[model samples]
Target: MLIGEVSQRCGVSTRMLRHYDALGLVKPTGRTSNGYREYSADDIRRLFHVECLRTLGLSLNEAKRALDEPDFAPSELVGELIGHTRARIAAEAELLRKLERVDAAAPAQWADVMGIVTLLRALESESGARRQQAVLSQNEGASLPVEALAAAALSEHDPNVAGALRWSLARAAGEGLTDLAIGLDSAVVEVRRRATVAIAAVPTAEATVLLRRALDDGDVMVRSRAALALGSRHVADAIPVLLGMVVEGRSDVEAAEVLGVLAEVAAAADVIVLAMQDKLDNTDDAPTRLRITQALAEIPGVAARGVLAELADDGDRTIAATASAIAHTLDRRKRQGFRN
Candidate 1:
């Protein structure tokens, strides 16, 4: 068959076929006398396998390596593919979380408040001290000293200044500033970075509110960070947000991280089971679904039984076998509990 026929049959593009050929990732079996690429039945089969691996989240390089190796075991290759899928899912999850954060801080009032807090903190710290010292040194030998000193001190304590500071702190806390602070120094960077740190410093109750707000933010990066912070705290309130990211968020990595954190929290078996069920139904993206299934199995209850059963019946032999292994482990635990 020619490239066009193979592409039509396999649903892969001719460009992709050509690129694959160039990369030695996929090649035709032979060539015609006129120099057109010729593919055999085995080539079609190889293409199908390559497509399956790609859908499973294997990089072209990884798929080629696995396929090219004569001794490659399907089980081993599946395992490697599973790991890669999990990583990609995690990255997507993170992107969703950042988007939520940006949405929450979209209001001008909110941004102004956060900006004020950053400005005040910058002033009260070493940066402020250096500025003050520089001003005093510059004023040395000037005649109008007493009035200027009083004016400067009063300005520092002005009601407007105080109000701005409070507002900024409130905004920062709302933006998950505490966690943001972990990565910063007194030397200020962008306004967003300052707001991130300041938001992280807010009281837990207030911070939770801010994080929740940001989870719905229009900006992906903001929502992503907010989800990430919420996940870190293992807050039950974040479960829905995390689930939305897993199901719909743009950034697979962030979503995966959120899911991983949620799994660690694993408070409700029903939630994990539902997530597993959803993943199974929505995507044949094997690697990500596998991670979700494994996470579901980790939850401590009988709710996961149905999901595990479904997974045990999966067409992918490796997934089915892994699911069976997990089911057996869970069954042992259940038996032990009954005996006790």
Candidate 2:
């Protein structure tokens, strides 16, 4: 077959076939008297082989060596090609993510688009300061996708950066609530803690409801935070978790204070007092009993007073002493109030 016929028959362009010949990658087997390049069957087969190698991302030199050298091992070259392909795929995926984030921002101008891109890049910076600054400026550009803030907050390590990220998410509120809610279920303890903190600050009814659900999370840290937030919001659902915190000695003092607040705000002081008394009856540990006795001072009203009076007679010396002191304090406050 001549060059043109070969081009049609093999589907390799005449120009490309000539270029391959020049590079000694593929040479026609013979030339006709008319000075046209003539390809034999063997030459046609080589051209087909070169095209096949090119399809596998082989460079012309590599493809030529593969066909010309009988001992050429494809294993090493194939491994290299796989590595290159993986790198390209990763690069392409990163680009796609950037585009999606930019589109989510809905930038009004080229400058806004660039700014959002810069902020997004800085959020991933190795410097904690840069990451915090990026989050603080998260609201400056076009609205970023809530997923961006959620992703940043979940992975942030530096205390300052994590606080800033949580604050930013809370301020953004409805924008990222769903994504932050999902982070509440993260396998990483720190991420779940951050999610709870961020969601706690969100001032929405939906956010409150989300935090209430977190009260049942397996992580004590998650449940404690959610319980505290709900307690402050007068959500009586936090009662069980708060009592558990007192019993487990995790943030027991703060839990007591929040429980007091919940009791006062919701007028559930009797209920709170009853729960404390139940724990007092079941618990045999001296220190846990001490914590519970101290926690009682935080609760208000006559019901808490009666519990304190009964605790004052307990067999434990420290428990009896603390309860006596708290009972006197509450009695003194009551007298002072009546005098005023």
TM-score of each: 0.37, 0.89
> Candidate 2: which pairs clash?
none
Q: Which residues of candidate 1, in runs, are more than 4 Å off?
A: 1-203, 232-234, 244-268, 328-340
lDDT of each residue in 1-340, candidate 2, tens digit only: 8999989988888899999999998898798998889989999888889999999999999998999899999999999999999999999998898888788768788988877788788887899999888878755434665677777887777989988877777777567888888888778888889889888888889999889879888888899999999999889999999999998899999999999998795367878888989999997999999999999999988888888899899999899999999999888988999999
Backbone clash count for every predicted candidate, in the order shown: 52, 0
As a TM-score, model 1 comes out at: 0.37
Which lDDT tens digits does candidate 1 get at residues 132-219? 4433332222221222222222234333443333343443333334434332322323333334333544557656666666666555
Task: Supply the global lDDT for candidate 2.
Answer: 0.87
Best by TM-score: 2
Local lDDT at 12 for model 1: 92
Winner by lDDT: 2
Worst 10 residues of 2 by lDDT: 138-147
Q: Model 2 segments beyond 4 Å from truth?
A: 1-15, 32-34, 139-142, 331-340
